[model samples]
Target: TNDPLVVFTPSGKRGRFAVGTPILTAARQLGVDLDSVCGGRGICSKCQITPSYGEFSKHGVTVQGGALSEWNSVEQRYQDKRGLKEGRRLGCQAAVQGDVVIDVPPESQVHKQVVRKRAEARDIVLDPSTRLYYVEVAEPDMHDPSGDLERLRDALKDQWEIENVTADLHILQTMQPILRKGAWKVTVAVHLGDGENRPRIMNIWPGYYEGTVYGLAVDLGSTTIAAHLCDLQTGEVLASSGVMNPQIRFGEDLMSRVSYSMMNAKGADEMTRAVREGMCGLFTQIAVEAGIDKELIVDAVFVCNPVMHHLLLGIDPFELGQAPFALATNNALRLRADDLALNIHPSARIYMLPCIAGHVGADAAAVALSEAPDKSDDLVLVVDVGTNAEILLGNRDKVLACSSPTGPAFEGAQISSGQRAAPGAIERVEIDPVSKAPRFKVIGSDLWSDEEGFDEVIATSGVTGICGSGIIEMVAEMRMHGIVDAPGLIGSPEQTGSDRCFLDGRTYSYRVYDGAAAGGPLITITNRDIREIQMAKAALYSGARLLMDKFGVDKVDRVVLAGAFGAHISTKHAMVLGMIPDAPLDRVTSAGNAAGTGARIALLNTAARGEIEATVRAIHKIETAIEPRFQEHFVNASAIPNAVEPFPILNS
Candidate 1:
């Protein structure tokens, strides 16, 4: 009988195995590293794999049911005792029954992903909505016959000076027991509502609960979701964690995800569940890191593009796929954590930043709030570069914002040998002008590939592939070294006078790095890769140019790159590649996940919610699709440093 095929992702290893062969056996045969400390006995449970069931058109695989065998006795017993994660199976016990795509989570693999997201350090004043009030109520007197609840209400009013405080319906059921336990002296956790709304008691704890109140701030990016656990009282970030947006398997970019929702009957619901589950995982992680109970997270603030904003709320994004891009709602939202199925306090509140437009969603609003481009005296340009680049330009007088479809090239989706920012992924690159040779640094190691003792490091974790930042630097360096011309064409060996330049078949290519081991693939930059970068950069520059034209400014005084990818990219390369308008290099800096930071601000300070809400309303929204000059600007910006616009600063 023919054997079943099993493919492992992040390593891209594939193998064929007979029936009853364990997944760990297949992985080992293919040289894929999966942790198995107990020698396939299923005791450690470290070798767990998630079998992706469905059609993955991009990878040309269709995963069917029974691809992996039913849970064995060992796996079942382990799960019963130490709960296995959803969709995960013990790789040693689960046998291959048919073709399948297995995802070895970063934690389960011997090699792990190097998470790069960090909480941007900023001081914020504490004005959290959740407040602790210590109250002393008169014990229920049989002589007076005043009810326990009524007397407690009166005491709350007299002691805390809070009026119209109502308890949640669940709180009422256990009120008597909690009152008796506290001996009428209890600390009530009150959650203040929006303007004109009554304050409500969220939790009533016996005695003074001296622990710190916690809140979560989340930036739900199209590619990644990051979370920060903060002390609601001190406005201090206690822990930060991030996970790859699980929706990537469904589709790579925003429009693709929207398209997936359009094509698949239950696509929207599936994506929603995936992200919520991912968020739940992050919540558990941050809570453990902070040494706090999961229920203590009483509040959360989120920011994401409109698509993510809609999907997270279970809204269909079908209309967003068409013209006019209708949004179900653009106003800031407040919903119960349980409504969204988030793992937090039962009565916790979730606040979402307002969406600026159909394309420019709450993430852009969060960027505007964190950067405050509208408050600047000089012309300020803020670009939150990602799959979709959101541009904000203006000063105190006027602000203009637009969204450009830059695609996933910048995030390493379209490029050959491209991968997400993992441990072995190349993140930094430098090209020597003299020899036209390149050296690079991977995420986990500090030393460059050309430096001493680099071979040992590369031996441990092989050079994986180029990431977003490395792509930017590679193209910019190619252009600077005259290996690429003004028309975005890679030069031949005769023209560049470098052996590194050669023609692969019809088009020219440059060797970036030789393989670390024999027969390993050489990292090469093809002409097609450069074109992908050009198209991505052109879209970004054109969007910024359109915003600048709306602002009636020739050049921006400063440029702020906002996002994780933006923070990692070199400012000089961004300018050289015409990804942003010309500005002094010193004035160009990263805002460092501005959306996440803005979410944190809103979580700690309620006033910020109102401030950004007003700011988004006052700002003008320009639709790039409707603009006529967008195409012309895009064509001109496709060239390095732009063909039409003069970058005198960079030229000097």
Candidate 2:
């Protein structure tokens, strides 16, 4: 039994194989992750592997030059056409000649891990719903009297061990021609199925499909619809894009949109059509950025607010706008692309995360999935700030959730000279405590307003307006430098000792920038703008405090500011404005778009879909609207950093 010893690196899986055995066969026998779509036929080059040869004292073996057989004709042919990397060999063609160590590159492994950018976040493991399989089928014969599809199924069952597979009518229509075209051998993209679904064919190719499929992880916000087009097999984000929600013309906030539906007969339908069109456009842009065909996208996962969820599904949101705030359904949905008129693969699967409640929607559930407060030992609070803020407070034993209607003030709506986060929008600000002068940075430029070449930096997108994050820091800096009072009012020049503060309409306004000479609009923070921010932050704080009350806690170990806006807001500025609860500044972290991350998690791992569903079921929902304590907290939170609740960390 003088067999060659084969060892696979990164996994440390070792086994003894016959000398002439194919590396792929040896890898399969030892449970190594070597991929192959065309079996051992070498038609697909997915089974590429690199072998090492040297003295190996640690592994207790001495490698030689003839460890693996020389590349065969199939490898040479593949290298000539597609060009394999130097020193790489096709595992399906290379035979084990002696003791050898093989390394499987990340791209070659089917379940490779996709590293996340966040230090504390979990990596996404590739385990998509749809996968490709190459199989050979017997051609149909009149004498045998067997259908082509039956023979294909038999081939799948015999070759791949897949059972009871079904195909859509579209596949059936083209199956005859494709089967004959491939000379009875074809590759089929199969949706492995979930819940009550049966394994079915999504698409078919003549032979082995050289290209991989794609999936979409979408975060459908009330203001914007964002999507991440990802490689299904690799879990890599090929492109990310977003578009402003077209429903903004109808209403800026969720409640207004709901009211519009109630007021107009066809308002709901019109809004639905607008949103759908917007989503389709976003998909097209994302696909183009990734340089892939839209039809290659076969799976999608969506996380959205309750109202958006209902509207997207063509359901009237009247119940969501009233008392009790009942949702039509809160279950996770699995559907087809055509059911929603999506322009992706016709048979693509769409999975929506489960909703937490009428107010706290699937977006909150997605946040929970990504942040996972329920699994934490330390009591953590997660706040997803937007038009409406979704707040969660919990630990290992219990968790409570609530929603606060923060409105569109945070997104720069309903404010004089305010705009969304865009180029030329002021995003960072700092004021001198003595001079009472301000220096700020706009979204598109890295230079500060007082720095050299600042004008040229903003020349293209010329100082437009203040955005949500900018307004937060501006007001916070105003309060810090005594330009604005704790009562949320801008002071007069005499009272504040700042000449930039000028009286306007019986109140005062702080002039951040005066661009009149340059033919640009004069940008100022009016008394009303502070009031809008106060209302938005108060609602956000009250929601968090309401959950704290329900959880019977006055403090939390950590605070995760989640959302695109949250990622940019300074934690110190946020605390000065009383946007969140008291916590160490270091403990207060930003989880950029946690709901979108959760959607990506669900898209890559099918098991995560079930995990989030179970988590959503266990979460306790608190209705902030009905709770009297919410009013009390709202009043207290209206002041800068709370009137009653002391932020000891911020104070220190």
Candidate 3:
């Protein structure tokens, strides 16, 4: 008989398996990480998979109910003991019998999981571009013989002192109904304009909107899209939510997406629709959570890197792929939400912060505004670590910015078993120097695998692959434990005098966790994994060094890690890994989602938009790709804490 064809949804990875082939084995062959703490013995019960037995048109796979084998004694025993949820089966015990489609939920996969979304606490003065006006328009008199729109405009000008306000064609079509329904007393949503432009009426509602008017401040990250629903009146963030970028299905990183666009004719358009749809979903979610109509969000501010910015605006990012990477436009954009296909008020204005350069984009400008590196007397270095690390350094007198290609290693890409920071992922690790015994903690659980009562805690989610932060700490801990050397070579048993270190073909591997006996897969750190981390960190550190050299400063007084990944990373581990320059531990801190906060500030204060625009223009951009010294810096930075540059603060 022909082998069974198994397909995994969302990722669209598929493989053919022989009769009785375990689902876990299929996932492994397809490079999908499913949590399995007990190898394939089914004791750990971590390799749980949900098989969807129906036509999955999106994935082009139809799974029959009898495609997989029945529950074996091992799975049944574990289920009786631990109480497995209905419709969930152990991937290790449930073998493939025919064509099947498996849905690896967030809890099952290491790379995909619930993203963290928390608004950064900051203060901003309210000066929103959107304002609501409740006006009582004069009844149209046959004697006066004035048009309804003209009468409405006269009322807005007379009552609210809003001058020269105009309505769009769509607004005009629905204007009469709203005015008549409100009995000539309606509320109008006005989008305030700058000194150069005239204010325009966005939305018209029957009667007064008793609820608060809202605006969305969005940080369109390559990996995650976070949004904050702010009260336009008070500038307070009423609700916050985030979702993984739907474009992740197309490509995991920005450059990959750009490449996809280059390869496919409609790639850019497809990605644009995916993200806009995701934003619309988020808008609906925030509105429901805040108990307001989605139309109440009359204004929005968006900040993203150059690629995401282009994709969101439906601009083809093909030019961004080559040297002298050109941006479609570096200027701050003011467009209609409808033009971008965002499901907000039809006439709502969308403000995008200015892009700093070809690589450094509006997100960088937002970060600069949030941190205000130029406002400080002391030299300040602000680093946003993502697939591309954006570096800003300087004081009030001079500010320098640069973009470094760190790849996606820092975000859990490029590693053999790497994943995004998510529940069930191994987030923290420790190894005993003597025995080389490893103990670690997953994201959802508080207890380490070796700690007491960990068995009950681990039952929630089994040990998955290492995430970004976990990968960093694991490599740093390996270096500290003498499992790996300065040049990033894993030590052999003969070299380290420990059995935990062993040879894997031509290279050596360090055993991080031995779970075979417990039915979990053996987790090991290969020499290649170390090199990937080194390359990523080296690029980041080299970029910072280039800026420091240009700024004529050997050391910065303060360092701000500005991003979600930065927020969770350990400063000590970062220093040990040479991901950043040396600084006093306390002096280095994360500026949790500073770009998102900056978007919020711009959403609330129109002046802030101008302030960031001016700041970005004043910032001198250093192109690391063109810099000759970047190679030298990267070579030195490849070693832990740098091979040449003395990290006196970190050494102490």
Candidate 4:
């Protein structure tokens, strides 16, 4: 046996590494970057390679047939040719005892976001919230019993009626010295109070950090992260750019991550480091791309789910994984950029919006800001569908929110073939209401319009797999055509994977193959896959229904959908799956990435910190697992979105 494992790519990319080096690490040393989220705990089934006949440890689990364990989380080959988990292996955990050749999945990446584009900021405007101001005070004369600092404080209290006049150590360090240098001129970043005594100072850009105080807003999602460089002088979004979330390294769904975090005391640290590193990298990239100094990022607003928030802060998420799931901190947290190890300006202030519960996080709070729930009386339902789905139901008087364990179904997970919103991912699809043929548009190409030669178009270019949005569309189409039963059971010949099946030894079924990938079919949606969808959709539906029942509201007046997928997927498709309530077209609104928007809000406005804290305290949490009825509701919700009624129009 070789002391060190040896692996090579088909194209002669080969290298040897210490025996202790995992396949992914070995691959990297050998110039191969493998994709293994969960920090390579051996899940996701993304990194898989076949051993060069006889080169693998007979005892070591193989990702190929006739050599590995019976249970491969990703592929079936682990057990026998009769059962292969798609030849999947976690590159990070799977150590090579011998030489092997591996193939990287198209979904694989060295980092989550390939391009981190920065946006140009809009003009700054000062609101009642706060601002970065430079002031010059008169030198203390003989009659001035009050010091220069006192004089400055008096002017602030007298002119703006501000109460809190605190100074940082850095600010005070130069306060006495600078009192004479610029004739007592200083720039202070003050966070204005919201009619309460929540006064604070975010920063003091010494030497007249001239011009409007610049800040950023960030909406961090489970799968994607977006940033908005804003001018604090004006509350407008200066520039905005978004990319996939880097936390995906852990898992695709919230529970999976929560489970992963329960490993040990160090789990939280690992999770937090992964997120911080990802964010820090993005911040540096965006700042550099925007042609701005990182120091200019003085303040930022952050909003995300409770798990995501915890992960970003390096807090343990294990508590949220079990019964009576609770949040680490529902109230808003204000931390210096350096504390969380975010690579923004050292003095930069980052405020995380308050969480409604362990599930409904600052994203909901941000959306609530838009709704101004405090002023409304009608029943409003705010549904944010991400890896973790948060649903808020109530009126001005009382509100109830519960986050369901809806995995990446809506974002294209658990489906036969699902993925985040990216190039080659199918964004839209239209089935011939007549022939039942499907015409879809791949995100990278604007070819859905090539209606006449759809097959030729796919053949010429390349069609990989149906994305989450496309899957929803196709499922909706199947339901309409009676090809799929209401409960998602494949119908007859034209039903299910029948006509399109492939030869899987004994059973032959419809095979899903993109033009580019014909060697092996990716998603052969089995009856089990259909059941998973049924369970997911049902959970979403029953959860919404139960919330409405609790609030004593018949139906929601308005439903706001949040998150990357929620904003983009067709509402009609969502309704078909019963993922959302069947409301009027106008009743449902798609607010693009409310979490990301809220993050940006915190980044730009320091005053928002207190407001978010108050918001967290104000909102109520609904524990879904409290009642046994929830299980029944979930089981019922597992059917198609809307059984047989007219589906709501999903207008963009």
Span of 10 residues, lowest total lDDT, candidate 3:
112-121
Cand. 4 TM to true fold: 0.70
Which candidate's lDDT is highest?
Answer: 2
lDDT of 4 by residue, 203-246 (tens): 55444554555576777776667777765554555566766666
Candidate 1 per-residue lDDT over residues 1-652, each given as its tens digit: 4687788886778877898999988998898878653456666677888987665532565545437888989999999988998899999999988878888887676443323235342445456778766677789777899866677678778865677887777788877888889887777777877755567777777765556578999999877899999877556678999998999888878888999999999999999999899899989988998899998888999999999998899998998889999889888998889999988987798999999999999999998888888788988898998888999998899889999999889888789878888888888888888888988899899999889999877788788789999999989988999999977989988999789988888999998877755435588899999999999999999999998888777888999898888889999998899999998999898888898888987888887899889999998999999999999999999999799889999989
Shift of residue 390 alpha carbon in model 1, Å: 0.8
Off by over 4 Å in 1: 1-123, 142-147, 516-519
- The positional error of residue 209 in candidate 3, measured at the CA in angstroms, is 3.4
lDDT of 2 by residue, 1-652 (tens): 7788888877888888999899999989988988878887888888999888775632565555548887789888888888989889999999999888898988788777887868335667777888888999897787899988899889888877789899899999989999888888899988889978888888888977778899999999988899999888778889999999999999878899999999999999999999999999999999888899999899999999999999999999999999989999999999988999999999899999999999999999989988889889999999999888999999989889998989888888888988989899999999988999989999888999999998796668789899998999999999998898888889899989999999899899999998887778899999999999999999999999888888888888999999988898999999999999888999999999899999999999998899889888999999988899999999999988778888888989
Runs in model 3 deviating more than 4 A are: 1-122, 180-183, 206-208
For candidate 3, write residues 356-463 as lDDT tens digits. 999999999999988888888888899999889999998899899999999889877788777778787888888778887778888898898888987765565666
Where is the poorest 10-residue window by lDDT in model 1? Answer: 112-121
Better of 2 and 4 by TM-score: 2
Any idea what lDDT model 1 has? 0.84
- How far in Å is the alpha carbon of 455 misplaced in model 3? 1.6
Whole-model lDDT, candidate 4? 0.61
Number of the predicted model whose TM-score against the real structure is largest: 2
